[model samples]
Target: MWLPLLVKRLNQVDMQKKGLQLTAEEIYDINNASLKDAIVQFGGFCTGEFISKEGLLLTNHHCGYDAIAARSTPQADYLTNGFWAASRDKELSNPGLFVDILVRMEDVTGKVLEGINAQTPEAERAKLVSERMKALAAEAKGPENYVTYVRDFFAGNEFYLFVYERYNDVRLVGTPPNAIGKFGGDTDNWMWPRQTGDFSMFRVYADANNKPAAYSPNNKPYQPKKHLPINIGGVEEGDFSMVFGFPGRTQRFMTSEGLKLAVETSNPARVKLRGKRLEILKADMDKSDAVRLKYASEYASVSNYWKYFQGQNAGVKRMKTVEGKVENEAKYNQWASADANRKAMYGNVLADINKGYADQKEYTLSQVYLGEAALAPAAAKFALNFVPLQKALKENKADDIKKATDAIKEASKEYFEGFNVPTDEKLFAAMYQMYYNDVPKSQHPDIFKTVETKYKGNWNKFAAEAYKKTFLTSPEKLNAFLAKPSLKTLENDLIFKTVNSVYNNYLTNINPKLQAARSSMDKATRLYIAGLREMQSDKVFYPDANSTLRLSYGSVKDYEPRDGVHYSYYTTAQGILEKEDPKDEEFIVPQKLIDLIKAKDFGRYADKNGELPVNFITDNDITGGNSGSPVINGRGELIGLAFDGNWEAMSGDLVYDKDYKRCINVDARYVLFVIDKFAGAGHLVNEMTLVTTPSPNASTASTSAEAAKADVLENVKPAVDSKTKVKIKKEERKAKAKMKK
Candidate 1:
């Protein structure tokens, strides 16, 4: 570990020793939900500089996919190997994707609190608050067109006004083929000592005058004033790194029950769904190169989530961190258990939310699995069915029927085309078997029957036949059979329409029943909350995330995954090489990377640790929105790209694990290697402004011995997972006050 493994505080992270002082302005700006477009977005994520002059923007590889997917055809397989324009003119245009620039921020806490207080009836209160906020946003105007969303927390205790400038000048720049962008596969996700190059490049295109623009071939790359320069000097133990991005989601403010639900119910359900998706996508991808290419991005997108869910599960289990969820729940229970009046108002609410979870618990989980498993194979058939549906709708035969048909028409174009029948069917069977064997037989009788009929009661039989007869083995026939104008889609035409019907039944019929259950549990929760609040009304509390700008800080850290499995804080060039398993398609590392390590060509970014890093750690609070953020040193130099977090901390999505969760990031050194060594784009590397270390001072005998010890103790992790020097329990430092302080 060339970087010092950071230790996270359950409450605070002290950084005074690092000369890490936040200006009063920076501290104020960081805490509020304001006009944060410069480096943060309302959605809780952002993009930042790598090479400021070259206009290079660094973000999560996955974050740019919409723009990437915008230009995708069934023919262009960009998501697999990724998109790279040989020249700027070749860049694909995506009009909708934009970078928001923060123009102004104001404290709207007073107004928001007033709005909340005026509303009664919880749901009505929520709606009223939303209406007032939207009216305010609609009234705003600025350099860029953007929407304003309101965030209310601590029961309307806090509010902040945000004004942003949206930049439509965004365009695809470069990305590694998925081979590099997604190396080390599922097993390595969310764990430390990772070797993925999870970086993607996008350019902000502006008009001749450098303002936002719609699609234009002549649009030039916008120049940014604060693009980060690479400090190739690299990272070492005891170094400081901070990430700036709109981390999309985090649950630093979840109730204990909410946290427990995430750990016990949500995570498992997500994992099951993702697993089903991967099972379907992998089979289809393997059947043909065309299918593989067409669905490459879609598949990769699903895989990212699949890996994430599993990683989150693993992260929690590895560190014995699940205790956080239970403890949090207990705290909530304690607070809510105090009185009668308070409990009556909230009792039903908590009961309702919880019962809602319990009711949909299985069905919601089933939906993700069922979506890909049962329906995707018959997609084209549904498409063909829609032609008749349109004709029927035109005839005005029946509004409800036409509505159903019209619904299928929209779904056919969106969801079905992205699927391959064989892959989907096979995936369905694997999951069906899991269901049949695992879930109680009473819950899903009809789907079980379909499974038995589709495969003749044999999971493999169904999978093999579905592959040979449906999507994978016969794509052309599927297209031909389903696309005929005269075709009337069968009720069994596995498509989004059918899935929608299931959803309607669930939502309209099933979900309501589930809601009723939640309503019941909510009775208990509300009662508890009410009682607790009155008893401790004088006590303070914080609100959960409201999709507003937030900041969480931790230090670079390493933690044990399992009893014997310890992951280091950072990975090195050696770690990447060690994980390369040629036989496994998912784990391949580039030969060029292997050569770079052997050659020791760190170029400008190797830290004093003397090893090129693959990924590093950070303590910045990030969630979904924080994807693709740059982890900068205290000097604001680019050092890493935030990617995944330790799986032990998955529950953090709903419960902040002060000690378990860590932000995983790719070291900037790998970004250079991918560009200079593998991509043969040394020009990009040359454009970067870099920092150099000052010469070391002469050391006396005792000082010399300590320096030597520091060198060895700091830089040990290489291609393999190795022990990296880490900071243990230490003193806390005060957050530096801004100028006013």
Candidate 2:
């Protein structure tokens, strides 16, 4: 059986138990309209779902952070106070944001595997597969707006083609204050028992005919074929749930040596480097509101992965991830040795992998340090721009120089907006020192020699002198220099010379060694993966995730992380107040939220216990690109938004541990509560079609009215106060009118 059949069986059992009464076709059917149409790739980076027929979309707050940051100012701190579009006309337009919806997918394995297989050389096989994919993709192309690409699966043993349509005009609808949406910040990120709302709302607009178009005032909200109906019924333990989205990557088939490199070197280096960088940025941000708003997105982006790396390394060691891979390798080797044909096909896989790691480790570490050190300094990074200017100056064309200079002038405003010279100087000194000490002397970049000779190995003095002399540090000075456009000045520039010295050495010395080692490792991996599939012929193996649309299913269940520590499946708003600290930037609780919680003003969004549910956890397998994926019950009704993974499962991207792996999701009720009660955006709520339950399966649902009423009654209702009761009644009446199809 294929992976789809296994998933179907899992869903079939789940639906029967949870009263969802849904079939596979309802979730993913090419012949009929299905729930798949409602899910779209948000901003080409995260997953999102359509909530309203008018294209009101829901995604995680962090997914929309960059756009929100772009629209933010100190005077109008949307990041801090929250934002609500009083009406569609008032919603802010996000210029570079867009959504992609998968039109369809088809297996192209037969076409991709036309050439000689076992006998063909690895390089030849790759070329043949690539050519076939390109040809198939070309044949599938239909319209200018639609995109097509082919993906490799099961280690190039399988291939599939996917077609998608793009929607460009996505606009901000509403968002909760950072204190609510990003409640626990880095401290609580990836840790369970969380209270973060972690949700955001946007709307997609199309042309008059409801076709994709550029942003225009006259565009209307996209009328989608299917939009998920919001189920007010909260989830319970062992309830059937599934997540459909684009998971970025998962190296499930990596060898032991690779895991060792990550645990020993890569993870620690990244965490240390980002820690210093974040400290520098946070200091400046705390001192000024202007700096805070300006660097908010950048700081968040850096810290998110910084913490992830730390947890990942710890998890790797705790779980003995490398040992597990070694065991798998041993099994593969045993299987290979038992048969002559198998041995011939995969004999040298393990030795080649080990050799590659041995050869590539030192260079890889050097490359990582170079990125964290030389590239970490703002002045050093900005200096690379002058290389293009230098090339243009050599051309001696007026237009070329003008174009290059104008580009630099245009980029200056944004470059300097969040930058603090003194903060970056400190970062430069620290990072430079770390780089010098971490990497072996032979692998050290040539610039370190200059530092040792000129400044007597004092990174602080070198940093001070470099910043004082670099024109790139000040936008005004850079802009002035750009006007004259002198090549001689650029050649003599200290920052440029320093960067070029390191960069040129990396290109000439370090990169060649890395490439040769990586090539050997890749070839061995490809062969090993193919051999593994052959050995496990009785079972169907799915491909590793590569930023393609995939469906994963599981249930909402609590997990025991360690000895005597059984974490619950969900967290409540009460936890927010419990974790509150005014002095801490991460756990600062908003007074409005605090007052509401204290007064028990849950309105009509509280659970049966009269408490507001904040976040929940599930076993639905997901990764980076699945950040804003909708967590749907078996009936395909949206119940929550997946935002993070538990700290115990940070190594999941490399190896999925079902026992410890859990996806953290923002409960749908909490998201709506923040939008209506907290942000006071009732009109936005009116746009969605909220249902007590998803339409039951046609085959299993009872025809009697009594049975339908009983099913609806089984789902808990949110408590309504006098004011909230009236508001909900008005919304119910409106929904009833809209349902008159």
What is model 2's C-alpha RMSD? 8.1
**Local accuracy of candidate 2 as per-residue lDDT tens digits, 1-741:** 023323565445645565545776777666677888898999888999999999999999999898887788988888988899998899899977999987788878888887556778878877888898998888888756478898887667678898888999999988888988888888788887788989889999999988889999999999888999888766677777788888888888888998888788888889988998898888888998887887798889889999999888888888888998889899999998998987887888888988998898888768887787778877777676666777889989888888888777776666786677887788778887888888788977678888899889999998888788878778678867886878888877777887888788889999999988987787688888888878888755667888888777778888777753446677777777777889887788989889989888988778755788888898888899998999988777888999999888999888888799999999988988888888889888888988765323322334575344434433422222211111223343343344443
| Candidate 1, 1-741: lDDT as tens digits | 100111122112354354344432332343442112235341134454435554566776666665566566657867665677777777666654677755555556666546344225666755666677776666655434654555554445445566665567566778886667877666666656677888878777778887767768887777654567676664654566565555455445434455455567656766675666677677767878766755766666667666676666665565454465456445655554555743444434444555555665655444444443444344423434454554564565665455654565455454554565556555555655665664445445454576567656777665555445432224455346434422233343433233444444445644566556555554354344444455566763334545444444445666654443445667677666666777777776667667877888876556555677778776556677667766766555666788877666765555556666688888787887777777877766666676653211212212765565444445432224222212222111111112114
Whole-structure CA lDDT of model 1: 0.57
Return the top candidate by TM-score.
2
TM-score of 1: 0.75
Q: What TM-score quantifies how close candidate 2 is to the native fold?
A: 0.89
What's the C-alpha lDDT at position 24 in model 1?
A: 26
Model 2: which ten-residue window has the lowest total lDDT?
A: 719-728
Candidate 2: count of backbone clashes, pairs at least 3 residues apart or interchain: 0
Per-prediction TM-score to the true structure, in the order listed: 0.75, 0.89
